[model samples]
Target: MKEERELQDVLVQLSSLAPGPADAPKPAGQALAVIKRQVKQEKRAGCQPWQRFWQNPNRRWATAVLSLLILFTVAFSFPAVRAAASDFLGLFRVQKFAAISVSSEQLALLERVAEEGVSPGELTIVNAPGALIPVNSLAAAARETGLEQVLSPAALGEPDEIDVVEGGDGRLIIDAAGARRIIELAGADPTLFPEKLDGKRVEVVIFSGVQQSWDDGTVLLQTTMPLVEYPGNLDPVPLGEAMLQMLGMNRNEAARLARTIDWTSTLLLPIPRNVATFNEITINGSSGLALASLDGQYGAVMWQQNDVLYLLTGSGDTVELQRIANSVR
Candidate 1:
């Protein structure tokens, strides 16, 4: 059987170089010589001392180990892989949320704003700030990732209050309920500002947040926008990327990825979903990820950098949010 297998192998090779079967009538002597010569060449091809190295048991292991090393080297050397790894490494560096407070008058204004009517349900701050202090604390993550503008410890106020009193964290805090009520009364939805949401519901809440205190008796305001507030028809990654770019990350990938997002998905934000997801697509040959807020109503996307994360938020005020996202350093 072994001999038969060898003969077949030899036959296949010989047939490749020989004349067609029609010429099989050639003299037996020449045919025998050709067969013998073919066998000799096949044998010689495998006879080299160097060729025999492949047959060594240790060499086979060495080759496998060497190949693995090369693959690993290449994998770690890739820019995409390297960036992802770096991001993972730096992710733990994010700071936790800090609680904040405002002056007594601002506290009074906040209470009045709530009286003016935005629902607490609309106010999405995770932690509740005390009544007298005024303002809330927020996850450092939001500010770090560029969602700062969409979120606030203070509510939106009238034009003069635009910079009414800058919080320790450098954000404009106002009695948003009052301002929003006034604006909406004029037919505007705070979410899609300038163009009112057209829904005739009363919003009556002043969102309080975690508070962070600075050395000068000043406190950084804590804040978060409720998922119900604005429809973030955007993926978190793209949102983040937009936020980052707006905040001064002028790299090509940040710019390219930020542009790929359609503002439509941002409308989905207010709709709730349990398992929101974010997908990162390659932009200009660089890596990016979209955060689908995993909720049905909205999603936002963001991109990862060695030491930063960015997100998108707010629809009508998207330009404003973009301005805010860009406001980050």
Candidate 2:
């Protein structure tokens, strides 16, 4: 009887305070204390009447809603919680998403490379016109190696001109225009690329091409279109060379083992499997991979030849692209 009387007293006070505006001043401390004490007593003693009321699903749901309301009230009352909530809600903000949103697997691959301390290979930083070494001016030594191999495909037409950039000892600097061209070659947004590429250096090989006229051997159907090529595996080092150099093996034995070793699979690009579509292509009888965009456009093409990896990307038709691929001599 005493507990019932106390509960009734607490309910009367709550009812009096509940009739005000939602944002009205909070209830008196004494009233809140009485309600808290009554609820604690009922919960600890498992009051038979209160337990029966909660047994009904509707009443249980109402209790849950009331609890949530109280929690939200307390949460908003704190400045920190309000700020966190505002920030948390900002993820739904409207904006353009960019292609720089790389997959987790790609990030993991980069981490693995960093951890393994693998060299990222040669880097090129394109400078102004005066700093660039014209392709025709390339030393015979550089041309003999993978550095000067002409990746310009025949279908794209003859390149107007080419440059051999030593990149100031392998560190290449690319300007904003070059960066924009690279992003387009990747079929990515220009915004996703580095904002300040003027003199910003990177480790990737960049063969930048600009077409002046279609008759001048520009591969792209559109004239004056910016075309960029990032070729990999242009030079293949024989494992036999390593054995002969490292283990001091005889030339004949190393040559025999190197001939037996297969180097075709070495030029692999680790594309993610969850992409929209992946199709197998044959480039000169060698297997290649083609990834298509969600709207059925050819997003990218990768193939290996002479132990070199060639990746071509743009907003081009697939059939025309295959013809262009054949021209990459």
Candidate 3:
């Protein structure tokens, strides 16, 4: 009930804060079409706002953080699937996976913020980083992505289709003032925001990758280590704690969790306890995270090996998922 009350209050605040029309840059035509079509489908389905929130195929923590960024920039500006963090050098790669528990109420509140507080036109896509281009063969995919070692599941045999995703650099100039205001409105501690973080820019580099799909609804994704460059003066710990608090976590809990994570090299995966089961598993010799739907119908295994992050998802149990992952070569 507390979260619901907060959601209503946030909705009221958002309505008042909605910006007037402006000439914000938009996504390219093809991307725009896809967005519009998806919106239409959602409207037709009459799905609840929270249900629609979970509908995203790429609902990782990185996506959640990007949504938060969009929410903060709704009046001024404006995202990825893979979760990654930077090293001391400011270049990010996913070296480990951490599972963070999120309650259903928290997810609902976050969805309400996104659906009621932000609109598409409010976000200006400054750079369209990359596109998924179909490739005729594995060798072609390797050539396009410049990946010396392209992996496939030996258990699954040949994939029906392969696509090479182009990667590029994109920058986001933070509107810290706006973000602070939003955090305050959400009943979080505004003082947690760092003053020096204002006007700072975060640069994101998407590394080229490959996606292979089979007719049976299996997907295998491999990408080079992606990078996120935070300003040298910025300490991501407080920023992360603030974001977590805004998501309804208590200050002490949020701080503890934030400090435990190495924001630069760990991918935080938010797991809804009511919907899925998560476990830390060993895949071959590498540590991995295994996730399965509560119903046991679908599962995924994500691991980083040899500087390449790999994700395998399919309609299989965790054991089967692990078997397929181990067969990757």
**TM-score between model 2 and native:** 0.30
* Cα displacement (Å) at residue 229, model 1: 3.3
- List the lowest-lDDT window of 10 residues for candidate 3: 79-88
- Candidate 1 Cα outliers beyond 4 Å, as residue runs: 1-206, 209-228, 253-329
In terms of TM-score, the best-performing candidate is 3
RMSD of each: 29.3, 28.8, 17.3
lDDT of 3 by residue, 1-329 (tens): 99999999999989976665674446589778998999899889986533442564533332333222222212212211011111112335668877766688876665554444422111233444436688899999999898887999999999997978666665555555555555565556767766665666666666788888787767787888666666786676776676667556899998998898886676666677776788999887899888787777677788889888887887778799899999998
Clashes of 3: 2
Candidate 2 segments whose C-alpha is farther than 4 A from its true place:
1-151, 165-264, 273-276, 295-298
Q: What are the per-residue Cα lDDT tens digits for candidate 2 across 1-329?
A: 99999999999988876745765656699789987998888889876643533554433332232222122111121232211111111111111111112344543443342344222122333342112234452233145333434456766654554433222112333344443432233223334333443554333222222111123222221111111221233222242222222222345664564455443222212233343354677766666655554454335455555434444554455555566777766
Q: What does the lDDT read for residue 11 in candidate 2? A: 96
Q: Pick the winner on TM-score between candidates 1 and 3.
A: 3
The better candidate by TM-score, 1 or 2, is: 2
**TM-score of every model?**
0.17, 0.30, 0.70
| Ten-residue stretch with the least lDDT total in model 2 | 91-100
How much lDDT does candidate 2 score? Answer: 0.36
Candidate 1 has a TM-score of 0.17
